[model samples]
Target: MTLPDHGGLSGPEEIARFIDDPLTSSVLTSMADICLVLSPEGRIKAVSSKKGSPVTGVVAGWKDKVLSELIDSMSTEKMRKRVDQLAKDAASPEVSPPRWVELLHMLGQGETLPVRYALHLLHDKRHVLMLGQDQRPTIEMQQMLLNAQIALERDHEAQREIDTRYRLLMDFTSDSIILVSVGSGLIVDINHNAALMLARTRGDLLGKSLADYFADHTRDSLVAGLEKPVQVGSAAMMEVEIKSSQRRLQLSGKMFRASGEQLAIIRLSDPGAGVVADERLTSNLRQLFNHGSDAIVFSDRDGNILAASETFLNLTDVPSASAVRGRSLAEFLARGAVDLRVLLENARRAGQLRMYATKLNTDFGAQVGVEISATWLDDQFDPVLALVLRNASSAGAVRPDTGSGQDQNMQGVIELVGSSTLKDIVSETTDVIEKICIETALELTRNNRVAAAEMLGLSRQSLYVKLRKYDLVSKDEG
Candidate 1:
C-alpha cells in the first residue's frame, strides 16, 4: 500500500508519516499478513495488519478494492467465513477473541488465497483483528487429499457393521458421494458431509436431478447415452469427472436394479485415483514422464537428469526416456547452460529466477529455445528448481526494461519528472494543506508530477485515476 505524497517537508518527512499517526503508520508499513478493514455497510475502510503477523510483501494492482469484491479473496470458503464472522463479532461486548485465516494450497504466481480463518473482535476498539497462516502446500496436498479420501472409503464399513454401514459410507465419505434414483437420475439421498463440502444445503440438493449438478459433458452424455443400460452390478464401477470452481473431481459409481427401482451410489475423488485402485501409481507416473505440459528434465544441482517428461523429450525430438534421464542440462542442451551466470547469481539473491530465456539442443541436432523460470525449494537455497518453461510468446510479455514498469511505480514516476524520489513524498498524503506543498514541489522540482503527487496523493481516491492518465494540477481553483 503506497502512501500519498507530501510536497515539501523540510527534513526527510515522508507524507505517509504526516497524515497517519506513527502507530497507525507502523501497522500499515509492517510486513505482516495484510488486513482488510471494512465499514459496517461493507465498503473497505482501511487495509493493514498488526506488526507481528506473519506474511510480508504482496503484489500490486490489488491494493484498494472493497474486501467482498476482490477476486482472490472471494473464492475461498475460509475468507468468506472470516468476513462474515468479523462483521458480526464487532457487535458483541463479549470478551474479544483472536481470529486468523489459513491458506492451504499454493495459488499460482502473484495470487493470495486464504484456506482457513480465525476471527477476533475488539468490541471496545470497534475493530477486528485477524492473523492468517500461509498453508500453501505444494501439489502434495492434492495427492494427500486423494489418499485421505481413499482411506475414508476403505475403513467406512468398519466404523459400523450394521446395515446402515452402507448409508454411513455413502454419507460421511470425504469424496462427493451421492445416491441417485437411477432411471430418473434424481438425487434420492444426500449426505451432510458432502453437502458441507460442496457449500450446498441438503434441502437444496435433495430430489434434484443429478443432471442439474453435472456440467454439459456429463449431462449430455447421461441424457443421450444411457439412462438405463443393464445394471452391471459388481462390474458396474464407472468413473465420471466434473469441474468444480477450484479443482476437478472424478466420481466412481455403481448401479443395481432392484424391484424395478434402479439405485446408484457414486464415490468421488481426484481424477487419477480411480484408475489407481491398486494403489499403483505407475500409469500416472508414466503420464508425468510422457504427457506433461512442460519439457521437464529432472536433474541434480550438477545438472544430471534423473528423468525427463515426455513433453520435454518430444520438444527436443528425443526418442527415448531411457536416453534422457541422468543427462546433464549441459548434455541436453548439447552445449552448456547459457545465462546460468545471471540466473544463478539472481536466484542467489532472490531465491527465484524468472522470465529468462536460453537455448538447448537434443540428440539429433535439434535446437529448441525456451524461457525458463525457476524457484528454489532446496534447504539453504541449494539448486532444486521448479521450472516454468515458456515459449517465445509467453517470454516476450515480461520485458526486463520497459515503460510499463516505469509508469506503474510512483518512485519511477517521480524519477521520470526529474524530482528527487525522496523529497516529494509529503504531497501524496492526506494532511490538510499537504496537497499544496505536493503541487509546489512538483513545480519546483521541474515538472516531476510523480514526486509531487507522491507527497499529495491518498490512501484512496483520484490518485489512481491520475496515475493511469498522468493529469495533475497545482492550482485548487475551487
Candidate 2:
C-alpha cells in the first residue's frame, strides 16, 4: 500500500533515513529508542527505532495485529509497561502531558540504558509524538552534579552552625566584649558587660566611636598601634585627667582579632578594697612580709618614701592622708625624719627586719628608738620596707643625748633577724618559680611570666621587654 507523506510528521527512523548527510546519519543510527506510530483508528504508520533494532525490523509484519498484541511478549517488562501506558493514553479522549522521564538506554549492541523521553500530544490529544535520546552519559553526569550539590549544601550548613555558636558565645559571655572595626575604630559591637563598664547603654555604644573613651596619649598610641603603659586598679586610681564629662580611665588590655576587627578585652580591677591611704601608698611587698606585725613603708629601695607607718606618722606628726603621700622619705630630713639608710642597709645585709637603735630628732623631739629595725621586702627595685621603730626615748619626752654615736641615751639593740642579704633571698625565691620552665624560656618570658614565651604564644622579644620593665634580667634566675 502507498503511504501518505503527512508533511513533516515522519517518525525518527524515517527522518534518519531521509537525511543525506552521512556523518549525522551515522551518528544518530548508532543509538536511539523509538515507538511505532499508530493512527487513532489503530493502524500502523512507521516504526521510530534507530537502524539496528530487531524490533524495528518487524514493524511492517505487525501492521494487522490489534494494539494489545503489537508488543512482543519477550520484551523487557519496563518496555512492555511503557508501551501499554502509551497505547492506553492514546485511546483516551484527552490525556495529560507525559512526564519528562529520562531513561538509561544503549545503542546497537547493548540494552536500553538511558533515554530522555517526552511525549507531546496534539491539540486534540488523540495523536502522540514521543521524543527520545540515548541519555546514559547525560543521566550519569546529572546524578554526579546532584551529589556534589548536596555535599556543598551540607558543608554550608555546618559552617553556619559554627558561626552561630561563636556569635552566641560573644554576645552572652560574662567577660566584657567590645568589637571595633579594625580599620575605622568604629565601635561595631559591645556586649552587656562592656556597655556597663563604659557606663553607657548598649544602644549608646553602638554608633559612638572609640575616641569617646581614650585619653590623648592612649588614644594616639592606640591609633598608631603603639604600646602604652596603663595602670589597672580602681581605689587610688591612676587618674586619667578628662577634659569634660567624659571620663578617661587608665586601663590595660590585650589586642586581639574578633569578627574582622582588632579590638581589646581590657579586664579592669579594683585597687585594694577599702585600703587606708597609708596602706595604699605602701608597695604590695611590705604587707605580705613580717606577718602584718612589721610596720610597712613604701620608699624607693633607695629611701625615697611613698608611704610610712602610723608610728612613722606619729613620729613625724604627719597625717596619714596628707603630710606624706608622694613625698620621698628623704624630703622629711629637714623635719627631723630619721634617715632610714643605716637600717635599710642593715636589713639588706640581714634579709629581714633587724633591731637597731638610732637617736633622731623627730617631731616628738630628739628621741631614741631602741628597737628600730628595717628590711627590704623584694628585689624587684620596689620601694618596700618592713620597720618596727621602737620609741625608746624618755616617755613622751626628747632624748637626753642627741649628739653622736657616743650619745648617752643610745641603746644597744640585738640584730635578731638573720644575716642573708635581701637580694640573695629574692634571687633564690625567683629561681624556684623559674625552674619549671627552661631558664632560657623564663628569661624569654615576662612579668614573672608564664612557663615560656612559646607556651603563651608570645615572642621572646616581648617577654624580654616585660622582664626589663619588672626589673627582672639574668640576675633573676626566675
Candidate 3:
C-alpha cells in the first residue's frame, strides 16, 4: 500500500492497482451523488450511487445500458459529443482537466432529475468515469426564488391598482378636500376643488401651512379646531374668510391616523356655493331667514318639521331648533291636524298659499293669531313646505267684535266669554294677564329678576314665587 518517494504513483502498475482497490468505488460515490463507468462507445458499463442518495434506486438498473438512454432526448447529442471528446482526450499524450456537462436525466413516471456530470479519463483509456452531483436541490431552490419573485410582482400590481382607485376618487369628488400633517401643520395633499377654493395651484398648496391661506386672526383657532377630538352634536363647521379673496367659507375637519402618524382631513366649502347662483344674494336670504321678524318653518310633505328659523323657535317658545325638529307641525297649530291639513292641501294645489289665517299654539299654552304664507318646494331630492308666519296682533290686524281700538290681550280674554262660567273666566283671565305682564317685565329687563321685580312693583321673593308658578324659572335663575 506504500508508495515510492514521489507524491503520486510511480508507474502504470501502481495506478492500476489503486484503481482496482475495494475502497475506490466508495471514495468516488462519496465525492459525487452518482458515479458511472462508461465504455468508449458511451454505454454504461457500471453504475454506483452514494448511500441514501435520491437517485440510488432510480439509476440501479442502468448498468450495461447506453448512457444516452437514461437521460432525456435533449441531452442525447450533448452526451455523445462529451463522450467523444473524452475518448479523444484519452488517446492524446497531453493531460487536461475533467470536463463537466449539465444533463437532464429522465426518470420514469413523468419525472426528471437534473445532474451535473464531469467526464474523467480513466487510466485504462477504454472507459470513461462520469461523476454527477445531484442538481435537484439546487433546481428546487431556484424554483422557490422564481415563485417568490412572481408573488412579489402580483402584490406590487395589486398595490398599484388600489393606489390608482384612491387617486381617482380623491380627484373626482366635488368637495374641496385637503390633507394636513398633524405634527407639521403643513398641507400634505390637496384635491383640484381645494386648490380652486384656495385660489392657488396644487403645486403652490403642497408642503405649505394650511393657515397661510386663512386670515391671521383665524389661523390658530382653525388649526386648534382641526386637532380637537370630534364630538357628537358639536359645531361641525366654522366660518373662515380667505385671505386672498376675502370670501367667507365653511371649514370642517376630521382627524384620522395613517402609517403610524396623525393626519387631518379638512373640507372648505362656500356657504352658498351649490345651493344658489349668487353667493351674496344667498347670504342676504340666509340673514333674513335667521334674523327676520317673521317666523319661518320648513315642513316635510308628511307635516313633520324639517327645520325652523330663530324667529320660529322664539314664536313657539322652544329652546332651540333641534327641540322642534322631526316633531309634527300640527303640534304647534291651534287646531292641530285640521290647520296643518288645510295649509298643506292649499299649498300643494296652488303651489303657494297666501296669508292663510290661523293661530299658532306656543309651548306655554298661549295662542297667537298668525297669517301664514305657505309655499310648496317640490325639490326632486327633498320636497318641503316653506311657511312664513306673521303675527296678526303685531301687524295691527283688526279683531272681529272686539273693536279696532281694543287691545289684543283684552280681545283674547273677551273671546273666552261664551265658553266658560263668569268666575272661571275671570280667574283664568287674571292668571293669563298676570303671566303676560310678568313675562313682558322680564323681557324689558333683559331677564334681570331684580330689575323685573322693581318694574313689576313686586318683591324679589314674590317675583321668584310667581316665576316658579308660571314655570318661567330658567335653569340659571333657579
Candidate 4:
C-alpha cells in the first residue's frame, strides 16, 4: 500500500478512488474522535468514528441527520455561518485552507458534548467533511483546579482570624509581658504594658537587646537565666535595677518553643509598688512549705484537703497533689475519723494542737508513725486548718519512758493472791496481762490496727476479735 507522490494525484478519477478506499476511512478516524460527510444542503451524508472511541455509539445513528438538528440551539447559528463562509471560500477563484470551529452538541438525556471541528471542501465541491476532537478531559481538569483554589483560600482566612485574636489578647493584658528570641537574646515582641514600664514605645523595644534596659552588672546573668529550661509552675526570678530610673524591679522568665524556634516569655514588676512588710515573710513561708522535709497540708474546716505540699503527696504514696485535693484528709489517717475528730476538737479549743500522734496509711498498704501539729486559722471570711506532719519512726529510740500505766497494771496482776481457787486466780492474771499487752502494742504503732497486729504476732482477723473483746476499736474502725 503506497501513497501517491507529494506532487499531486494523477487525475480526478485517482483522487475519487483514494477517497472511497477503506484505508482513507481508517486514517481519518485515527486523526479525530468523529468524522462526518455532509451534502451541500447541510444534511449529514455519512458519519464515522474511531473503533472503541466513546463517541462511536453516540454518532452511530446520526447518518442522514441534518447537522443543525444534532447540535445545541446556540451552535446552530455558528454552524450556519461557518458553512456559508466555506461556500464563499470554495466559490472564490483563490483556493482557501480548511478552518477549525468549536461547537456544543446536545446528546439528549440531560448530557452535552464539546467538540472542536475543521471543515474541508471536497475536490468535487458538493460535499463537506467535518473532523472533531473531544474537549471533555480538558474541561474536567480546569474544574478540579478551580475547586482546589477555593479550599486554599478558606484555610488562609481561618489562620488569619486566629492570629488577630492572639494579637488582641497580648495588647490588652495588664501585666508587663515581653517575648525574646533565645538564640539572639533580642526582643521579638513587647506588650503595651511592658513598653510603658520601660519608658519606651513598643516599636522602639522590639528588635532591641533585652539586657539594654537593665544595669550593666546584671545583663549577663539575666540573659543566661532566661536561656535555661523552666518548670511549669516555678519560673526563674531575679531582682535588678533599671538603667534609666535606678529603680529596682523583679523579673521572672519562662522558656517555650514556637514555630520551630526557642523563645522566652518574661514578666516584669516593680518590687516596691505593692510592698507590704509581711509579704516577704509570707513568700518565705510558702517556700518553706513547698521545699521543707516535713509534710504539710491545708484543709477546710470540714477536714477536706484544700492544698497539699509535694512532701505530703510523697508521704501518702500519691502521684500528685491534685489527686488529693477536695478529698477527706481522714482517708490517709490510720485511725480514720477518730483521729481527725480528736485533732479538730483539740485545735479548736486550744487554738493549736502539738505532738498529736497518729499513723499515715500509704497507698501501698503500709503504715508510718507520724506526729502532727495542727493550727486553727480563723480568718474573717474563710477559716481553715493547717497541719504539719513529721516522721516519728526514727525518733522512737529517743522517746521518753512512759510505761507507768503498764507497771501499775502488772503490779495489780501480781497482787492477785491465793484467796480464791488457783485456776480462778490464774485466769484473772491472764486477762490483766492480755489487756496491758494490747495497750502497749497500740501505743507503739500509733493506734494502727494493721501495724499493731503485725507487731503482736497475730493475724489481722485475730486482732479484730481481741479488739472487739477489749472494746478498744473505735466505732468508725468497727
Candidate 3 pairs with clashing backbones: none
Error of 2 at 443 (Å): 47
Model 1, residue 379: C-alpha shift (Å): 4.1
How many backbone clashes does every candidate have?
Answer: 39, 10, 0, 0
Give the per-residue lDDT digits (tens) of candidate 2, residues 365-405. 54435455566777575547655555565476343432343
Better of 1 and 4 by TM-score: 4
Q: What tens-digit string does per-residue lDDT give for candidate 3 at 170-229?
A: 899998999988777889999999999999999999999888788853445766876564
TM-score of 2: 0.36
Predictions ranked by TM-score, top down? 3, 4, 2, 1
Tell me the lDDT of model 3 at 138.
Answer: 89
CA shift of 343, model 4, Å: 30
Structural similarity to truth (TM-score) of each candidate: 0.24, 0.36, 0.50, 0.46
Error of 2 at 200 (Å): 2.6
Write down the lDDT of every candidate, Cα atoms only: 0.52, 0.51, 0.78, 0.78
Question: What tens-digit string does per-residue lDDT give for candidate 1 at 1-478?
Answer: 2223322222111212233355644543453444444344444444443333333323122234444555454344665676577656556667546656664423357554543434444333444433333344434587799899999977876665664876777666676777777677788877776565445788898987776555544544553334444463342333343334443555556766767897777655666645665456786666765676766554555556666677777767778888776666666442254243334444555777666655567677766677677665466655564455554435454534323423445453445344444345444322313333344434332344443344343432455454334434433211
Model 3, C-alpha of 307: deviation from truth (Å):
15
Q: In model 1, what lDDT does residue 182 have?
A: 68
Q: Candidate 2, 147: how far from true, in Å?
A: 4.2
